[model samples]
Target: MINQNKKTYFKERISSKKYGVLMKKIIIVAIFCFFIISKFTPIHGQQEKIPVLMYHHLENNLNSNVVISPENFEDQIRTLKEEGYNSISSQQLYDFLNYNIKLPENPVLITFYDGYLSNYELAYPILKKYGMHAEIFVITSRILEKNEKNSYLNEIPKMNWNQLRAMQDFITIQSHTWDSHYKLVSNNGVKNAALYGPGYINNNFEEQLQYEERVKNDLILSRKLIKEKLGYEPIAISYPFGIKSEDTIELSKVAGFKMGYVIENKKIIKGDNLFSLSRITVNGNETGDELIKRLKS
Candidate 1:
């Protein structure tokens, strides 16, 4: 009787220890799953806003709406520095969006569009002085044509391949599209230029297939040319005129672009679509204070 009683007690104790081990394993797995789920779960009231600022020309052409004077541009750069705004790279922004990478306490992005010579001549030095950086979106068709010694659109001068390569450290060169910088009118009466919109002097309508084909070809050619000339594939494109359609957005992704920037929406928040990002457009007219106000989080 004593032996049997001792055996029963040992069996119960061993079973209890085994049950405790199983409970511990289940608790550990539950904690790990909760941690993973928490990463994707929405926080009650917290959303991060990343501001992307847009600028066109940095030259002193008062008659031109897009041209900003060097003095004013320098002032803007100084203001950003004084305000403790950290100018981050496009890839950093992409990583932050896609990987939840942490940025500075006050993060911002400066973007220059259209591959202007003034960006190298005027803006680069100012940015350097401020210890800042910017992403320059080039109309690849213009750069390629200029390189080929062919006539450019509107006789506008753009940064050549040599200039771009020389200033690559401070400026990230991306595509603004190879040749789809024009407008195309739809089969209906609507007209827009970023992706498609502009019939003719007579406002004729464009066929759907023709518009899609144009977008695809332009994006593919742009990606190919940039890879061939720049030796690295561009990852983003600032929509021409900050205008883009659903079709154009998808085409951008298909052409290997990870992010496509639009003109409006003042601020970029945490959950904004990577394919269609928005920026704050700063014209040459706004004062440095106005630009800062526009960038408010």
Candidate 2:
């Protein structure tokens, strides 16, 4: 009887040990699953960083730092589509930044600095094919009144108003400025952006008030021209050469621009300065894979 009691005690002890081991394994698995859920799930209050890509021109054979070839542009656009990046409009961005509205997953903005004819002839079709949205900040003074064919293969042409209107389905037209895209040489021969300078030009010093008035006027005119032609007010301005003075934001606000963009080569996040938003300047030399890596970086 004593021997039987000993055997039964030993069996119960062994079973308890086995049960403890199973419980430990279950607890470890639960902890691992919790860690994975926390890692992959979106937090309630997390803000998203949006990448804004800036392109200047597109051409068939021309290759330059600012000019991307048509093939490369299409490749880039196609890759973006494959990567699940959704293109958002400026208004959507503004609403998201200001009103705390939720944006679509993997939101990005594709922008062009100048309204080049190639944007219409080459880039527009690819963008449309991929069902992406983009914006072009046109120098209002450079837009031709009517569409015209390019006669010279070597000529770098600007998009006309008709072309601009035609691409409105896929492209948003914004402002580069009416005529403030030029640079002024100061008395010391140091050049300054016309919109940002109150410095000496042609040996004459422009007063601060004079500089403010000049910039304000140009901004107003650019806004006016866009509204008149496009039937909507422009809410953003791309600083010429991405240069601006200390008062640039205030001046833009007074002239009715809701936001400003710069070529600072950074992604924009919520709570970023609205007036000096950042953009990634895309060059012809970057491959589609490189661009995807850049966006991830």
Highest TM-score model number: 2
lDDT of 2 at 233: 86
Single out the weakest 10-residue window by summed lDDT for candidate 1: 196-205
Q: What does the lDDT read for residue 66 in candidate 2?
A: 93
lDDT of each: 0.79, 0.87
Off by over 4 Å in 2: 1-46, 148-155, 187-189, 200-202
Best by lDDT: 2
Q: Model 1, which residues run further than 4 Å from truth? A: 1-44, 61-65, 144-150, 197-207
Give the clash count for each candidate.
5, 0
lDDT of 1: 0.79
